[model samples]
Target: MNGVELVCPAGSLPALRAAVDNGADAVYLGFRDGTNARNFPGLNFDQRGAREGIRYAHERGAKVLLALNTYPQPQTWSRWTRAVDQAAELGVDALILADAGLMRYAARTHPGLRLHLSVQGSATSAEAIAFYREQFGIQRVVLPRVLSAQQVRRVVAQTDVEVEVFAFGSLCVMVEGRCYLSSYVTGESPNTCGACSPARAVQWSEGAAGREVRLNGVLIDVFGAHEPAGYPVLCKGRFRVEGRLGYAMEEPTSLSVLDILPELLEMGVSAIKVEGRQRSPAYVAQVTRVLRQALDACHADPAGFAPREEWVAALQRVAEGHTHTLGALERQWQ
Candidate 1:
């Protein structure tokens, strides 16, 4: 419970400020390029914006984590290295990286700079984390959203590397660093291009069949007359399966670990991440506030901790599909 940072997402300068102002202990953000994931239109930070954000976050005693989470092509490898240099120059508190080469470059070039393993690194076990920690001096690792609470606890028990788990925002059923549905349809995926279902390929149309969305001309979902549309990703798309239209891969939902705050604290979890950089600043502010409140309550009295109704309601307001899950973090039956 002590020194457990609330790591919130900041896709833009506005979101960064909102997260910091809302009691976030740290904020993770990406550059406006392929070097980091969550590269979307009108999103991410430019050099100037990153410097300002660093200042804003530092002034409030909050750390700023620069994400260099995407893999690199041989021809475009310098882009990732340059981002690492710029992050160090701009005074980022740490670098969240997935690529081994990038992590090595950062560790070698700026030995004092802290390194964190991004969830995209796919380090599910302590052995994998130990490799990064021993090779590149990664001080922390963001666990992918695939581990049950028991599994995560086991990993933590085996590794000294700080653990950061996603506590809120969208669900990725495919697991981080490996999902290829976007590339299968759009030729670009978060792994290299830093965007899934890249905005350029997303098509929305109104027709007699209520509404429909497509990615790269492939039909993804057809909405009902009164149904709400979610993110234009194929994973959550409702499709005709066995003669009935339903979600086959995964449903549209967000992950919330409100019910397991005490368990996380008990496991010596170093951080809890909020996973929305594509969302608005309002979303960041609201989620950060609710999580901040919940963390404070849990830390105050872990044995007596219980998520407040209002806090849960506040999180649902910004949750995908207007609902939330404990995600892989819950496995009481197991």
Candidate 2:
């Protein structure tokens, strides 16, 4: 990293301010419609809200990146294109897009606007990144949470475009663009519908078994009196494998790269991004403050950069399942 940039999530105006005020280099957010991935109820910004958020970020010397990251269906092509125009008109610092068609539209129509390839695009290879940089002149690419630190170094060494990786937040087991387990259960996918497990389809009730949660009438999880109920996403749900009920797919855990911040910066990662856009402003504020302190500490003493126990504990407190990992950034089995 030439300069350490901490990119935070902002699902709302207050979240945006929280990030900027806490020393975030940039805050990424989406509109109130299907244009962004975190399109849940009571989240995202309208035009007026986007403008206000952008102003607040700029005034604080931070950047506001607009996420128009969902794919545009044939029936909704104009809607996606119009969103690109709106982001430009609203003066967002950059446009984070995924679909090649949308990226082309942004490149040709709003050539001057900075474009970041969303992690949904899954450009983990240097060749994939090169194609985007050559075709649309994308300034940066947000890598999916599937690459190790050495892998990140390889991609950075080969590509001219900037690279951003998730530093803290929810850990997904698959490349975001390809995950369809949720769609199989809920008929909605975050890549297109802007929600992994859309809130509208979730059903919860107290039963003699303690509690049960379902998505689109599909049983996702059943919790006993002592078991904590995780989110209703199918991938993170408990399942029966070999007659043993457990996390057959993936566990409820968060990704925290605090242990490897020095390695990431040393590898020349252009930015570190936090991954909670659907969380509360308080979540945004807390995570931002922690990452800011850690990043500053790294700069103040690069050779002495070691993750503080308190930082790990603070992030773990809000982590999914109250646990954290380096994700695929470091595979212990390897």
Candidate topping lDDT:
1
RMSD of 2: 1.3
List the candidate 2 regions with Cα displacement exceeding 4 Å: none
Candidate 1 regions off by >4 Å? 332-334
Error of 2 at 329 (Å): 0.9
Q: CA lDDT of 32 in candidate 2?
A: 95
Would you list the clashing residue pairs of candidate 1?
A: none
lDDT of each: 0.91, 0.90
Worst 10 residues of 2 by lDDT: 325-334
Clashing pairs in 2: 1-268
Instruction: List model 2 lDDT by residue over 90-200, tens digit each.
Output: 988899999999999999998899999999998999999999999999999999988887898999999889999999999888887878877888888887788898888
Clashes of each: 0, 1
